[model samples]
Target: MAGMLNIGVSGLNAAQAQLNTTSHNITNAGTVGYHRQTVGQAARPPLFTGAGFFGQGTDVTSVTRSYNQFLENQVLQADNRRAQYGAYSAQIGQINNLLADSTTGLSPALANFFAGVQEVASNPTSVAARQSLISNGQALASRFQSLNTRLEEVRQGVEGGIVQTVESINTYAKAIAEMNQRIVVAQAGGAGAPANDLLDQRDQLLAELNKLVQITVVDETDSGKANGAVSVFIGSGQPLVLRGTVSQFQVIPSAADPQRGAISLTAPGGNTIEIAESLLSGGELGGLLEFRLVSLDAAQNELGLIALGITETFNAQHKLGVDLEGVLGKDFFKPIAPTVVPAVAGVSTSITDVSEVRAKDYRVLVSGGSVRLFAGDEELASLALAPAPAWPATLTGGGIAVSLPGAASIPADGLLIQPTRNAARNIAVGISDPREIAAGGPVSVTSPLTNQGTGKVANIDIRDIAGMDGSGDGVPDFSAFALGFDGTGPALTVPAGFTIERLKMDAATGEWVTDGSYPSGGSSTTYTPSADSSGVQFRVTGPGGYTFDFRFSGTPESGDAFSFGPSVAGVADNRNAVALGALQTTKVLGADASGRPTATFQSLYAQTVTTVGNKTREVQVNEAAQESLLDQATSARDSVSGVNLDEEAANLVRYQLAYQASARVMTVAQRLFDELISIGR
Candidate 1:
C-alpha cells in the first residue's frame, strides 16, 4: 500500500512539473529571444523479477528546450541581409529627398538666370535686361554654393554612423565571449545544463551583430572543460571575438584620412582585413557605407557632368560674344578650379569685375572664322579636316557674328566701340553697306586689323575650307575657319586622309604584294591633283629618289576618287596639316536664327528648365516605391517574431493554476501520512 501511494505521489509530481514547463513556454512565447521548454520523463527503476522487471514510477529526467539549430542559423542569416538593405535604403531615401527638393535644388535658379540672359539677348542695348541677367546669374551661383555645402554635411553624417556601428559591434562581441566563459565553467562543475538563459543571451547578441557584419560560429572543445567552447569569427575562421575568458575584436580607423572615419577589422597576426561591401551581401554597416560612398559618388559625378556640359557650352558662347561696352576685355563666364567641388563651374575663376584689372592684362581672344588653335608650328590641317560627327558645328560662344548681306558700306553712325584683345572680337572693317554683298567673287572686308604689322589679319571665310569634306564623311562645312602661316614657308599640301602601312610583299610573292620594307633605293610616293584626269599619279618629287615608278593597275570606277595622306620628307607642312577655314556664326538660342545669337540664347535656357523638371519627377517616384516596399517587408517579418503583451498575460494565469494544483496535492499527501502514523502508534 505504501509503495502504491509512493507511485501515485511521483506521478502527481511529474504531472505538475510538466504543467509548469508548459506554462513557462507559453509565458515567454511573446518574449524576444525565448525558446519553448519541455519536461522529459522516464521510469525510475524496475523491480527484479525472475525473467524481467516492470517500471514502478515515473521520474523527471530533463527539461530540454524545443529548438532547431539549423532553423535558428537560417533566421540569423536572413536578419543580416534584411538589416543591411533596410539601413542603407532608408539613408539613401533621405538624401534623394534632399537633392530633389525644388526650392533648394539648383535647377530653378539656373532656369531663372538663363531666362534673364534670353531677355538681355533680345535687347542687347537694354541696361535693365542686362542688370536682371546678372542678378539671376548671381542667384544661380549661390544655389550651387549652398548645395555643395549640404553634400559635405551629409558626408559627415555617414562617417558618424560608421563610428557608432563599430563601437556597437565591439560591445556585443564582449558580451558573447563572456557568456561562452560562463557556459564552460557551468558544464565543468557538473551543473544540470550550461545555463540555457545565458546561451539565449549570447544568441540575441549574435543576431544584433549580423546587422553590422557577417559572422560564422563553430563548436569547439576546451581540453580542460566538460562542454566544448564555441568559437566565433568573421566569414572564414578569422577569429575575431574569441570565446576564452573574455571576447575582443580590433577596430581601427582608416589611416589615409582620419576625417573620412572609415573603419576596418584586424586579425591577431596584425593582418588587415579587406571587406568588400558588395561581397558582404548582408551587413548593415557595409550596405550603409556602399550607399554613402558608391551610390552617392555616382550621383555627384552625374550632376557634375551636366554642370560641366552646360558650363563648357555656355562659356564657349560667352567667349565669342562682346559683353557690356566697357567690359570688352572680360570673359562672361568663369573657369572652375580643380578641387573637391560639388558641381562643374562651381569653383570657377572668372574676373567678375574687369575694373579690378587692366584691359591689356585680360588678353582675351574671341574665336574668328579663319583662326585655328595650334599646339606648335606643326601643321595639323589633314587631321583637323577629318570629320568628327559628334562634334557640334555651332560655336560654343553665345554670340553670333553678322555681316551685311551684300558688299555694301556699313553705317559708322552709333557703332558700338570697344577695344578687345580677343582674336574673334567683332570689328567694323572698311565702311560698307550691309545690303550690298554679292553672292559671287571675294568681297573686300576692311575690318581694322589689331596689329597689321604683326600679320594678325582676322577675317571670316565661308568656303569648302570650313567643311570636313576632305576626310570626314559628311561633317558640316563651316566657312569661317582659318589657318596661320609664316609666309616664308612651303605652300601647304593637305591630305584627304591618313594612311597606315599593312602587310608587305613576302619572298614567296615575287610581285609587289605588301611585304618588304623600303629598300636602300626603294621610294615612297604621294598623290596630288593631276594635270590631266582627277586620277592620282605616284610621282617621285626628288631626283634619284625613285627606285621604280608605279601606277594604279586597275581601270577607273564610278564614285572613286584619288585620296592622299602621307607626304615625302621634302614636302614641307605635308607631314600633318590642319585646314582652317570659316567659323560658323550660328546663334546659341535657336537654329532658325542661324546668324542671330540672341534667339539661340533663349532656346538654350528653355532646354535647361525642361530637363530639371523631368529629373525632379523621376526622383519622387523612385523614393515612394522604395518606402512602400520597406514597410511591407517589415510587417511580414514582425508577424513571425514580434512580442505580444496579451500572450504573456495568458501564460501567467496558466502557470498560477498549475502551481496551485501542485500545492494541493502535497497537502493531501502530508495529511494521509499523519493519519497512518497515528493509527500505527
Candidate 2:
C-alpha cells in the first residue's frame, strides 16, 4: 500500500508542478522581452535486482525553455538590415515630400515661378511681365532656402538619436556583465543546473544587441559543471563581450572619414566581443541611420546634381545672349556647390575661401558680336567644370591648358583659358536629321574634354564658326559662315544676319529639327567659285543635310527678341525660358524676405508664363517610388521578428501547468508518507 501510495503521489505531484509552470507563463504573457519556460522531467534511478530493474518515479532534471539559437540569429540579422533601410527611406521620404510634394509643397511654387518666366520670355519689354517673373524667381529661391532649413532639422534629429542609442547600449552592457558574475557563482555553488532566470536575462540582452549589429555567441561549461560561461563576438574570433563573473564590454565609434560615428560593443578584451543593443543589427536605430544618414544623403546629392545641371546649362545659354538689362549675360542660375567633399589632400583646410572662386566669379564675354569663352586658369577651368564629369579623370598631366576667346595671349597667371579647339564638350552627343540645327542658328558641341587630342572633338567649333562656307563662298568667308556642328556629322550652316544659331534638340528625348525655311530642301546659292571651277554652285545637302525640319524649343511669343544661332546652340540650351503674357517691374527681395514669398507683396498676376513644368514632374515621381519601397520592406521585417500576443499566451499556459504539477507532487508525497505510517501503526 505504502509503495503504491508513494508512486501515485509522485505522479500527482509532477502533474501539479506542470500546471504551476503553465500558470506562471500565462501570468507573464504580456511582459515585454519575456520568454516561455517549462520544467524538464526525467525518471529517477531504477532499483537494481537480480533479474531486472524496477522503474522509479520521475524527477525534474532541469527547467528547460524552448529556444532555437540559429532561428533567433536569423531574426536578428534580418531585423538589422530592415532597420537600416527603414531609417534611410523614412528620412529621405521627408525630404522628398518637402521638395516635390503636391499640397503645400515647394514644387508648386517652383512651377508657378517658371510659368512666370515663360510669360516674361514672350514679352521681354513689358514691365508688368518682367516684375511677375521677378516675383516668381524670388518665390523659387525662397523654396530652396526653406527646404535647406528643414534638412538641417533632420540632421539634428539624427545626431540626437545617436547619443540616445549610445546611452541605452551602455546600460545593457552593464546589466549583462552583472548577470555573468551571478551565473558563474551559481555554477560554482554546486547548483545542479544553470541559473535559468539569469540565462534568460542574458539571452534577452543578446537579442537586443543584434538590433544594432550582427554578432556570434559561444557557450562554455565549467570543467565539471553542466552550466557554462557565455561569450559574444562580432565574427570568427573578434571579441565583443565576455562574461566571467559579470559581463564587460566596450563602445567603439567608427573612424572612417565618411561615416564618422560611434558604435557600442560588449567585452572589449574578451575573445568573443558582441555589438551592443543600440548598435545591433535588428532595430529602429539601424534603420534610422540607413534612411537618414546613408540613403537620404545620397538622394540629396542627386537632387543637387539636377539643380546644378539646370543652373549651369541655363547660365551658359544666358551667357551667349544679351539680356535687356544691358548686362551682356548675367548668370541666370547660380552654380551648385559640391555637397560631397573631394578626396584631395588638404581640401578642407587649404580651401578656406570658397566665395572667391565661386561660379559667379567666372564671367562670360560676348564681345565683337561673337562669343568669346575664357577661364582664369587651367586649374580654375577644371574646377569650374568638375561637376560636368560623372567619373573622376586620372591626372596624367599635372594640369591641362585651355583655349579661350579674346585671347591676345594666355593670361600671365594662366587666369584666362578656354576649351582647346580639340577639347570636347562633356555632354552626351545627339545625332539625327540635319534639320535639327535651325537654319542660320547657333549649334553646341555635345562632348566636353578636360584633356586635348581625343578622337571626339566637335566637328564645328564655336571659335571656327566664322569660317564655315554656308554660302559656298570660295574665299571661306569667315563672317557670313556661322555654322553649328554636332560632334557627329550633318552640321548645320548659319546664313549671315540670322540670329538663330543651331536647331534645338531634346536632351531626354532624342528628337531634332530646324526652326525656319528649307523645311526639307534648299536652293543652290553660290558665293565665289573656287579659282579652279567657275560654274560650281553650292547646293545644300538634303534629307541628310541642309533640309530644314521643324523642332520646338522654349516657346516665345511675338515681339520676343530671343534667337539662337546655329553656331552657338548645344544641349545646354534646353533649359532656357521666356515670359510672354504678363509684364511688371523687376524687384529684388532682401535677405530676410528670401523665403517668405508673400512678404513685401508684389502683384504681377496677369503676366504670360512659359515654364519648364515637364521636368519638375519627373522629380516628383521618383521620390514617391522610393518611399513606397521602403515601407514594404519595413513591414515584412516586423512580421518576422516582432512580438506576438497569441504566441506568448500559449507559452504562458504551458509553463503554468508545469509549476502547478511540481507543487502538487510535493504535497501528495507528504500525504502518502503519513498514510503509510498510520497503516503501519
Candidate 3:
C-alpha cells in the first residue's frame, strides 16, 4: 500500500509540473524572443521483486526551452543584411533625386550660362548682352554653391547618424553584458540547467545591437559547458562584450580626414583601437560608412571638378582675350586652389592642367625621407628626399602640381590633398562689370584676296597677349608681319620687332616638332620645306611681348601669304567671345583609358546623376531581396522556438486528465489500505 501511494503521488507531481509549464507558455505566448518551454521526464528506477520488476512512476528531470542555434543565426544574418541595404537605399536616394532633378540640377544652370555666353558672342558690343552674361554667371555660381551646401548637409546628417548608431550599439552592449552576468548566475544556481528566459533576453539585446552594427557572437563556456554568457565582436574581431564584461564603441574624427568620423572600440582595459570602415560589412553603421565613401565623397568631388574646370579653363581663355577697354582679359571666375590638410609649410598645390584632373582626393605620406602620393590606396608617385627636399620643387600627378618651397618638411602624419573638393563651395564670378568681359581677340589674322593659293590660315591660338607687347605700353604693338609659302620653302617678312618659331608635323606621331626659331631682327628669313610636310605651324611673338600660334593648312602657291596684326580697338570683333562660348562643348573634365577626353561639363554631371541613380536602384532591389530573406529566416526560426496557444491549450487538457487519473489511483490506494486495516481488525 505504501508503495502504491508513493507512485500515485509522484505521477500527480509530474502532471502538475506539466500543467504549470503549459500555463506558463500560454501566458507568455505574445512575448518577443520567448521560446516555448517543456518539462523533461524519465521513469524512476523499478522495484526488484521475486516474479518481475514493477515499473515506477515518472520523475520530472528537467524543463528546457525549444531552441535552434543554426536557425537563430540565419535570422540574425538576414536581418543584418536587410538593415544595411535599407539604410543604404534611404541615403542614396537623396543624392539621386538631388542630381537628377532638372530644375535643381547642374544641367539647366550650365545650359543657361552657356546660352548667355552665346548671346554675348552674337552682340559683343551690347552692354545688355554682357550684363546678362554676368548675371547668368553669378546664377550658375550660386547654383553650384547651393548644391554643395545641400551635399554638406547630407554629409553632416550621416556623421550624426553614425554617432547615434555607435551610442545605441554601446547601449545594447552594456545591456547584453548585464544580461550575461545574470544568466551565468542563474544557470550556476540551477546546477547546469540553462537559464532559458535570461538567454532569450540576451539574444533579444543582441538582435537589437546587430541592427546598428554587424557582429559575431561566440558562446562563452566553462569546462565545455555553456555558462550562458556570449562574447560579441565587431569590425574584425574587436570585442564589444566578453564574458559578462562590456566594451564601448566611440565616434572619433578620422586621422586622415578630420571632416569625417571614424569608429573605435574601447576595450575593458581602456585601450581604444580604430576600426577600418571597410571591415564593417553589414548593418546601419556599415551602410552609412559605405555611403560616405562610395557615393557622397565621389559626388562632391565630381561636382567640385566641374567647378574647377569652369574656373581654370574659363579663366585661362578669358585672359587670352581683350575686354571692351582694349586691355587683356583677366580671370572670368575666381581661381580655385587645392586644399591641403595639416598644412605643410612652404608647400602649395595647384591645378596645372584641367584636362588631366580626376575627381579624387590624394594623400601625401612622408616615410623614410621620401614623399609618396596616393589616390586612395593606389600610389601614384613617390619622390625621394635625397637633396634635403629642395625648395620650389614640384611633385606633379593626377593633373595637379604640388609646389614645395625650399627647406619644406612634411609632417609625420602626412598631408591630405583635396584638389577639387571645395571648389563648388568657393566658386564665384570674378568680375562684376559687364565691360570687363573679354570678347575680342588681341591679335587678328587676315588673308589678302590677291593670294591665289588654296592655303589659308585657321585655328589661331593666343599663347600670351602680354608677349606681343614689346613696348613698355599696356596696349599691344601692332606690326605688319607676313608669312609666304613658296614652292621651295616658307619666308617670313616682319619689321624687325618679332620672334618666329618654325614647326613641322612628324609623319609618325602627327605632332608638330619645332624646326627653328628666329629672334628679333634675325638675318635668316627663309626655311626649306620637307617634301612630306603637308602643313606648317608657326608661333609669333610681337614687340610688346604678345605671343600667338597659327597653322597654315592646304597647298599654298608661291606668293600666297597671310598677314598678322593687332585687333582693332573698340570694334565688334567677336573672336574671343566665340572661343569662350565654344567652351560649352569643350571636353575638359577627365580622360578615358585611351587618353581621350571622357566628358564635358554637362556630360560629367549627367554621369554623376546616372551613377547615383543606378546605385539607388541597386540598393533598393537588394533591400527588398534581403527583407524577403529576413522574413523567411524569421519564420523558420519561429517555427522551432515560438509558442503556440492552441498546442498549449491541448497540453493543458491532457495534463489535467493525467492529474485526475493519478488522484483516482491515490484514492483507490487509500481505500485498499483501509480495507486491509479492516481485515486486520
TM-score of each: 0.54, 0.52, 0.92
**Candidate 3 lDDT:** 0.84
Measured over all alpha carbons after superposition, the RMSD of each candidate to the real structure, in angstroms, is 19.1, 16.4, 3.5
Off by over 4 Å in 2: 1-23, 33-35, 46-58, 74-89, 104-106, 221-227, 235-238, 244-282, 333-681
TM-score of predicted structure 3: 0.92
Most accurate candidate by lDDT: 3
By summed lDDT, the worst window of 10 consecutive residues in model 1 runs over 574-583
lDDT of each residue in 1-681, candidate 2, tens digit only: 444445555665665666566665667656544456676778878878998987677775666655555555555555555554555455555665555456544446646865776765555445566566556655655554555556667766775666676566556656666777777787668465656566767877876765554567777666754455676665334454566433333434432212334453434344433343334443556555554433344333323322333343344444433233222244554443322211233211111121121121122233343223232222232223323332222111111222232232223222221111101111111212222211112332232323221222122212222223355432222232322322222223334443232333444333343424322233211121122122211122222122222222221222222122233422222212321111112211111212211111122111101011222233345435544544554344335533355765665565556546645655676787788799999
- Computed on alpha carbons, the lDDT of every model, listed in order, comes to 0.43, 0.41, 0.84
Per-residue lDDT of 462-571 in model 3, one digit per residue for the tens? Answer: 87776555564555665657766556545544446666676666664344555645322341244334432365576666665767777666656777777877777788
**Taking the tens digit of each residue's C-alpha lDDT, what string does model 1 give over 168-200?**
877877777777788777766746365665666
Tell me which of candidates 1 and 2 scores higher on TM-score. Answer: 1
Instruction: Please rank every candidate by lDDT, starting with the best.
Output: 3, 1, 2
Q: Which stretches of candidate 3 lie over 4 Å from their true place?
A: 405-408, 446-459, 470-474, 478-480, 485-547, 551-561, 593-595
> What lDDT, from 0 to 1, does candidate 1 have?
0.43
